[model samples]
Target: MTNIYNEINALEGAFRKTAEFETLKEAVEVVKADEEALNVFKNFRKIQIELQKKQLAGEDLLEDELVYAQKAAQLAQQNEKISAMLEAEMKVSKVIEEVNRILLKPIQTLYEDIQ
Candidate 1:
């Protein structure tokens, strides 16, 4: 209930950070794909499957609880993606720093030659 909602909110908040969001998103996707096999989603799947059938028949889910869970999924996905992006960014930054260090050695050599 409240705990679920809080996790949803935190995921949403971290959504914009691409690396984190990607990481979170992958986790969320995995959780969703296995929800049918997972205990927590087992009970809900019955209703969810029915809801999907109804939706296909032109009826839609109108309950706030269902919507909240869906939102939680999206939020979690976004957070995962953001986390991933951050990690990638860190790696790229490190690579750039290393490159700069290597390039400076050549510049130093050239300066020494000029002198």
Candidate 2:
């Protein structure tokens, strides 16, 4: 049988070696150096987590919450450091999401076959 743990470890190593990871690290450092940007980024993440929880629980998301997030995003975009950080974060997130989808393909195929 294939060693899934080893495969996952290999994936982790590959991820660490990617340019996206380096860019993300640099972006993080830039954000860390800027107090205002850091605060805005932190607040944005807090709001995002709250919204995500509500969405996950099947609760109705209010328009005000969306507007709040939008405003936070706008503010982040106005600051170059925060904007770069957000972009880097999005790139990293996309990479992880794609990797996860690829990893789950086997299970998805199995379910499809069973049904």
Candidate 3:
């Protein structure tokens, strides 16, 4: 029988070697080296986390908070390093999502025949 844990560990190693992961690493380094870009990225991430927390708590977002989040996103996008990092993050997330779908296929198939 195959060792699932060992297979997962090997998949983790392979994931780190992917081009999407490499691009994300480079983009993050570029953002870190630029003080202004790093600040913008941090602020945007902070806002994102705060908004997500509010959502998880079932609270409605205030208009001003939404506006501020939108403005922060714009600022982050205007920073070249941050924009590149965000793009790289999206690419990496897409790859992870595909991997998750593939991993879930067996479970999905098992449920498909249930009455």
> Which of the numbered candidates is closest to the native, going by highest TM-score?
3
What's the ranking of the predictions by lDDT, best on top?
A: 3, 2, 1
Candidate 3, overall lDDT? 0.95
User: Which stretches in model 1 have alpha-carbon errors above 4 Å?
Assistant: 1-78, 109-115
Which tens-of-lDDT digit does each residue in 70-94 have in candidate 2? Answer: 9987887999998887788899999
Q: List the residue pairs that clash in candidate 3.
A: none
* lDDT values for all models: 0.57, 0.90, 0.95
Model 3 C-alpha lDDT per residue in residues 1-115, reported as the tens digit of each score: 9999999999999999999999999999999999989888889999999999999999999999999999999999988888898899999999999999999999999999897
Tally clashing residue pairs in candidate 3. Answer: 0
Better of 1 and 2 by TM-score: 2
Once fitted onto the true fold, the runs of candidate 3 whose alpha carbons sit more than 4 angstroms away are none
Better of 1 and 3 by lDDT: 3
